[model samples]
Target: MIRIEPRQSSSALMTYGIPVLSAIISLLLASIPLTFSGAPIGASYFEMFKGVFGSKFAFSEMLTRATPLIFTGLAVALAFRARLWNIGAEGQLYLGAMAAVAVGTGVFDVPGVILIPMIMVMGCVAGATGMAVPTLLKTKFGADEVVTTLLLNFIILIFLQYMLEGPFKDPMGLGWPQSSPILDQGMLPPLMDRMRIHSGLIIALICAITAQFMLARSVWGLKLRAIGENPSAARHAGIRVNRTLMSAAIISGALAGMAGVSEVAGLKGYLTSDLSPGFGYTGIVVAMLAGLSPLGVVAAAIFIASVFVGADSMSRAMGVSSYLADLVVSTSLLCVLVGGFVARFKFVRLIQKKEVTQ
Candidate 1:
């Protein structure tokens, strides 16, 4: 009989080497699709590399793409740490974008300093409320959070569509299904005048650093990790499980909502259904790649963003399908998951021996 057994300790190799190894594998896997598309594998990869790091503009685009990813990644990491399955971050992101538009689209007459804060606050609240509904269902009615949260994404998307198409649509948009542009004063300033990179990148980094610090040094962090590792033990030790979970969920949702704020105020300066490009769902991948570490999420987000940006560049240059990006990302995620599983468990073959004395 073969049996799988849990590992008693974390593997340093798995922790340190897997990401590097997974990255290499992800790059190598691109060759398969390149061959299928009749593209020169070597030149395709070169273009990808160039797109990500060869030019200043390419690098800036990668960072720009990473901004919202960092926020959503942190959200997933924090929630997963507390065993909260918050699959509705996509919806929360839309809610946040919607809220920002409501406030930043001439709804407030205040200065950017005040108007910006209001926009961010409303976004955070909207995101928190999005997660709160599912959390409440899980806690109060024993409903499955995975189901509720996943379903809520559709509800929120439809609501956003209605708002944009009917109530919030820009009259001057020429029939486009998008909201009015956010006021100029409400926009986040650029990091550099000639680049698309904005102050939002700084905000994302600060949030990542702050989250890491909290997870490392704070009491709530201790409770969160403890509950994540073993909720029964945490409860026996007098920790309030439900309360901690609720707080974590709120923080997670708030972080995700902030992604919406970043996109609207910093990048697009407007709200639309296409604002996210699935950043919320991709954040789950980033969190998993980072092993649920807040700081690691930064690196993971950048890496994923690079892959996407590079893939787009490569696709355009090589005349191949853009879906190659998804293929590579999915492959990378699978490798990491398989590596993690190997790190956490081992299989043993049991040999039965018969007594000769019989």
Candidate 2:
């Protein structure tokens, strides 16, 4: 007979080591698909690395891709830390982008100093409102937040589509499904002379640092961790579990909303239905890869961004499908999940003997 047993204490080394090991294993597994596709596994990987880090332009583009991921990853990380399965970050991101578009398209004619902050705040508010429904459903009606949030994502996507095809559609775009271009004042200024990287990167870094500080040094963070570990025990200890969870949900949503804002104001300069290439969904993987650490999220996001950017280069150079990047990412996520499980528990063969007294 075989039995699964939880370890009394998990190894600290394994806890951190699993992510790296999983990544390596994922790469090895990914080589199978590469071979089947008639691509040189080693060469493909080499090209990917060279594309991401070999040139200044490539590095800048990678940073731009990492920017929004940082926000989305932080959003997922914060909620997961509180044991809240907030899966509506995708919806929240779209709503945020919508709000930013509304504000950036001369909803107000303020200067950049005022307009920029206004757009960001509006985006954050929109995101928070999107999450409010799921939070309330879970807190007041005993509904599952996971279902509510995930469903909300589809709903928001449809809503965004409706807006873009109707009220927010740009007449100058020749019937394209996109919003009007953001005015200069509402746009994020580029960080470099030639690169498209913008101030959003700074904002993402600041948010990550702030989140890390809150999680590590604040009383509220302590309460949140306590609640995540055991809500019943936390309630018995006089903690307001519902309120804290609600706060977490709102903050998480707000962070995700910022990702949308960053994309519209910093990169595309306009809102579109396809502004995100599944950044919100990918963020769950990023957060997990970071072990839910806010600071670690930065590194994880950069690494993920590099994979996608490099994959694009590889595809262009080696006649491979760009979907290979998605495959590797998905495989890495699976490896991380399995590695975490193995790290936490062990399987043992149980020896049994017939009862002699019978």
Candidate 3:
């Protein structure tokens, strides 16, 4: 009989190695599509590498793109750690971007020093509001947060379209549905002269560090972990499961909201319908690939961003669609999930010989 057995010891190396292995497998699978498309696979991959890290500027750009990814990845990771599936980060991102625009342009007229921080706060608040719906339903009404959070994504997308077409659309944009330009003071300080890199990258890194600290050293984090493992047991132990979940959900939303603000205020200098390019959705993949580790999420975010930045060059040089980047991310994530099954459970088959005797 064929059987599957768990490893005798769950090594940290194996825990981390899965992502690397899955990435290799994903790359191999991606090549099949490129081959079918009659593309020069080697040159395409080479161009992708060059585009993401060939030069100092390219690496800087990759970091810039990774900022929001890290934030959203952390958002998903934090919630998942609490055993809460927060799938509305995409909607939260849009809401946060919208709030940043409103506060940046409508209520601010200070120097960059003041305006940037204020806009960031606004964005975080907006994101928290988006998350509150699911949290409230789960905590108060005993509804399933996963379903509500997932459905809210579509609702938020519709709201984004409505705002872009009606209230926020710039009249001088030649009928393009885009927001008015943000005030000059609202733009994030560039990390270096002549680079699109911004302080947002620093913010993401710091946030990741903070999350690591909390999860590793804080009492609150212990309570969260307990609740995640067994809510009934946690409650019996006086952990206050509902409160822990609420806090985690709010924190997750705030992080995702910051991601939206970073993209709008730091990169685009204004809100737009395409503010995210699905960064929040991409973050879910990042969280899964990282095994819900905050530190792992940071590394995963950078790797995913590399794929995106590289795909652009691949497309230009090899005439392939950049959307293939998404395929890389999706495939790797699936492999990660499949690889985890071995860590969590064992499978075995039993043999029977009674039929011949009968």
Best by TM-score: 1
Candidate 1 per-residue lDDT over residues 139-162, each given as its tens digit? 899899999989999999999999
Q: lDDT per residue, candidate 3, 18-48, as tens digits? A: 8888887987788988997789888878898
**Runs in model 1 with CA error above 4 Å?**
1-5, 346-358
Per residue, candidate 2 scores C-alpha lDDT tens digits across 244-318 of 998998899999999999999999999889999999998998899888899989988997898899989998888
Candidate 3 or 1, higher lDDT: 1
Better of 1 and 2 by TM-score: 1
Cα TM-score of candidate 2: 0.94
lDDT, ranked from best to worst: 2, 1, 3
How far is 349's C-alpha from truth in model 3 (Å)? 11
Worst lDDT window (10 residues) for model 3?
Answer: 349-358
